[model samples]
Target: MLARVRSTNLAVPRPDPGAGRTTGIDKRPVDRIEVFRPGPRYGDGPGVVGDHVGDTRHHGGEQKAVYAFSREELDWWEGELGRGLPDGMYGENLTTEGLDLESLLVNQRVRVGDEVVLEVSVPRTPCATFQRHMGERAWVRRFTERGRCGTYLRVAVPGTVRPGDPLEVLEPPAHDVDLRTAFAAAMGDDRAARSVVDAGCLPTIYHERLARHLAGEG
Candidate 1:
């Protein structure tokens, strides 16, 4: 019903491998972020005031405009891994509390404080970059198996955002497909993949890959 952003994070753009790539996945920290209602073309675009993304092609765009992870989930990982995970550890631009990000359905719309409106698009697929960021062996596999991959959002309205800003769901999708479903689909759950495609709210960047998975082509 109500959620708040615990922190906002961004990276300093680096060549090939980004500066955020730490042997421990330590990312740059920030207190607040300017949320472009129409969010930038991507994390590196003009709309975003100060954030930098390493791989524009894969990291940021309209559909994958922003990445959000749950503070609660991060805490869970802290307990499981017996280590502290601060905000932005997963390269998430927004660290949220009081929302079940993993269960967020595609097409769900959220209003941040009063300025920004965001549409849930898809689940962030864990990658080698993430593994290297965390410096954990089998990190990708463990993340996938846990099924708590965070959600990406498309900007529908632009406004500046800050830590402690409230996030309210403006709309919820009619379908069952959600972040977990998308992650499961990517992890070889044919039924879940088909469900994601059928929901038809997935971002364009993810379309081809998920479609192939659904069709047994990939």
Candidate 2:
């Protein structure tokens, strides 16, 4: 199977009754999207133009400019949950096919179609918003245990991306810290956390978290 984008998704606002907040977790497929580096999570918004990001505190920014998930993983979840999980159901901007997202190293670059270049930055951490979105009991714990958290990307080269665009993964960085290891780190694996910190390719948040964890403050 060739690596390509099965769909491009944009946020669809939904009311989070649990938290009394609006969430953009309900994403739906779109024909096309403009991709760019949206500087900081606080001031700037989603890297995909016209996309809505309700929770700026935790999501959106240069490091999380885009989110990509594999269709294979979605299929696995569909069977596990006994329901049809469509493309973009997991709030990913790009529903990709035939890519091992977990194997992608931090700082690895991939070109989408002919234009956009994105760098693998981090793994999508399951959070309260995601749990509420799924509405499954202990969804966060289940997702974390599964450890197929998908990948978050930072826009390196701005351009337009559309459905069916081919994905060209560039050479990986020297570090061996892949998304799986990073996800494990996020899940409190001290060894994995140390590996990610040693890689030194990810955003500062990971470093700070590791520091807090070591200090027994996290």
Candidate 3:
């Protein structure tokens, strides 16, 4: 399940000084991550983004380039072509460039051809920084709350992954409960909320610590 990806465009951050706000989104760069390459950005560490004040968050982390796939995807598919998701998101380690992240079920481990292995965690959640960057009148929160935006992934087996590797799905969607689905269901519906919570598939902040979920919370 390998996949090739390209930064469809860059999300440039412009400062909003007159409004006392800072940061904006620009869809222009093809590989914003590579542009931000201050040096070798990958290694055996958590490829955490966010802790910054800009778009295409790949700042302050160890593993490697923390990219966010936008309204693009690998020019190929190895499985189901699910629903249409977001067009542009502000923060992420690897923005599918276009593919759908929701289809990757949580715990349905993905191995980037031994280059990288990450168990699906959840889609990236929007924050104040996102709203500030996008400046779309709550659009940031809406996208995240609605499960359209992609999120973060804590690297389990740290390895190098580029834009031309296959995004192999090591396992299929389990019980139809991927992070994207869980997020969409949990936020507004109590029944779906309970299910997502019970499964601990919700974001770490939204998760409920049941005995079952504890075992896999690693």
Candidate 4:
């Protein structure tokens, strides 16, 4: 994998990537997301607040997109990226400053918007494309084990959201049932596997797969 880092102006994130900085991605918190297509709920502006992500192929809801992270993860990213993680550099939507991504446990409850609560599901495991982008040596699988990678979320209940909005954790995870645990349990007892997946709030396909595995069909 090639570490395609541009010059400081291009590579590094913008305007104080500090954890508390809410202006840009680098400063944002967990439960993070950027609206490529701000839908109906999102008002028109440069980085409007209380906006909706819009519709997708699978899930349907007024509030479309969501993101998450912790203060520690942002700091960690700064260390990993070797500077401020500039916006629009690596295609990362939400910067998630100071949130030690490695510590973001599975099944963690990441409240995106005020009323839009979402649970952290599976880590964003790097595919070949990611390998090409980051290096193959980037240790993509480590993210899965550490639960450092961000998870895709489906809206449980719709709510209005905006950039710079504070992300809250309505419910914290009960013990760290990270991806490692999930994979392990999945390979072990069927019911345990199913339980772990359900508890993690994984994507529907994963949840269904676990259910099937529990039924002894897989």
Candidate 5:
């Protein structure tokens, strides 16, 4: 089956007393969104024009311009949590289908619709805000252990994206550092961390973290 966007979502303002004054974790489906490369998280917010990104310190930037989660993974979460996980429940901008996000290698490129091209940059890391959003006990731990964290994309070619847009996943990169491995590395797996560092092509922040990990500093 061809990969496709099941839904496009934009943030809905909600109070988050923990980190940012407000949270954009509650995203609702939208008809369409214009994708672009927002330079950095501190100033340039979400790539999807008009989407809210309350926590700029860690989210939304050129490397994390877009976040995508697959329906298959959501289904698995639904079964695990014994609750319905609607599209965008995980704060992803695009709810995709027919894609094994975990298997996608870092730097892999995907064409959305007819114009926009996104490069897989990194895997989403679970934070306190995410745990609070899910309202599940030990949500972070569960998510980390699963190692099915969604993929964050960099807008290589900007354009409009809408529901049902066909996703054309391009060929894999030379390295074999898939999202699963990356996620594991982020969660402190020594071997996975080495693999990610060896693969290279990661964002600078990740490189720094990997370096620290290798040096027994992280």
Candidate 6:
């Protein structure tokens, strides 16, 4: 089934107390986001529209410009966490529906609305900020084991996007590497992780970590 953008969220770089440290992970909802062809600072810099990211070292850039989480997954998390996970609560720029986000391949291209096109980049790695945000004990471990980490996208085409926009998959990469596989590799399996790096589908943002894993340095 074709997926649709259920809701869109944006926020300027702001201090997030709930971020549990000096992290800019807290994003508030905004009306619209003007997307642009990705660059070094596509999601975190001034040129992009309404959406802004807190951390550049690990969060923003062409490879992870737009973070997307499926409402379906959120529903599941809500059940597990025993509470409602409002849209944007996870700091996702787009809350999608009808898409199997976990299965999307790295380098897959998806068209949103009439202009914005996004290339799937990588699976989000849950961090301490995320655990603090949710206030759940063992949140990171649970989230990692659950393996439903949402996807990050690089803006391939620029345009304005809003809630309820149409979403279409333009193409999927010709590789076996998927979000879960990469996640597992990063966690420990050098063989699995090296495959993802060798596939050349994942952006450069992940190379350093993968290299460390392969070299027993991570």
Candidate 3: what lDDT?
A: 0.47
List candidate 1 segments past 4 Å from native: 13-26, 37-47
Q: Residues 74-168, candidate 3, lDDT per residue (tens digit)? A: 22211123333333344443545434677667656666544666666555555565555545676655565546545445455655555444566
Residue-by-residue lDDT tens digits, candidate 6, 1-218: 45888877775455557653344455555666777645675345422465565555576667677888989988998898899888888878888999888787878889998878888887888887788778899998898888888888877887887888888987667897887787776666678788987887665657777876677775
Counting clashing residue pairs in each candidate, in order, gives 5, 0, 28, 33, 0, 0
TM-score of each: 0.86, 0.96, 0.57, 0.47, 0.97, 0.87
Q: Which ten residues in a row have the lowest lDDT in candidate 5?
A: 39-48
lDDT of 2 by residue, 74-178 (tens): 999999999999999999999999999999998999999999899998899898989988889999999999999999899999999999999999997998898
Candidate 4 residue 74 Cα shift, in angstroms, is 5.3
- Checking candidate 5 for backbone clashes, the offending pairs are none
**What global local distance difference test value does model 5 have?**
0.90
Candidate 5 ranges beyond 4 A from true positions: none
Q: Please list the residue runs of candidate 3 whose C-alpha ends up more than 4 Å from where it truly belongs after superposition.
A: 8-70, 73-89, 141-146, 173-175, 202-205, 209-218
The CA-based lDDT of model 6 is what? 0.76
Q: State how far residue 37 of model 2 sits from its true place (Å).
A: 0.9
- lDDT for each candidate structure: 0.76, 0.89, 0.47, 0.42, 0.90, 0.76
Candidate 6 residue-wise lDDT at 56: 56
> For residues 22-124, what per-residue lDDT tens digits would candidate 1 score against the true structure?
2222446687777654343554442356666565545666677778898899999999889989888887888899999877788889999888888887788
RMSD of 3: 8.3
Better of 4 and 6 by TM-score: 6
lDDT at residue 6 of model 1 (Cα atoms): 86
RMSD in angstroms, all models? 3.2, 1.1, 8.3, 10.8, 1.1, 2.6
Give candidate 1's total backbone clashes: 5
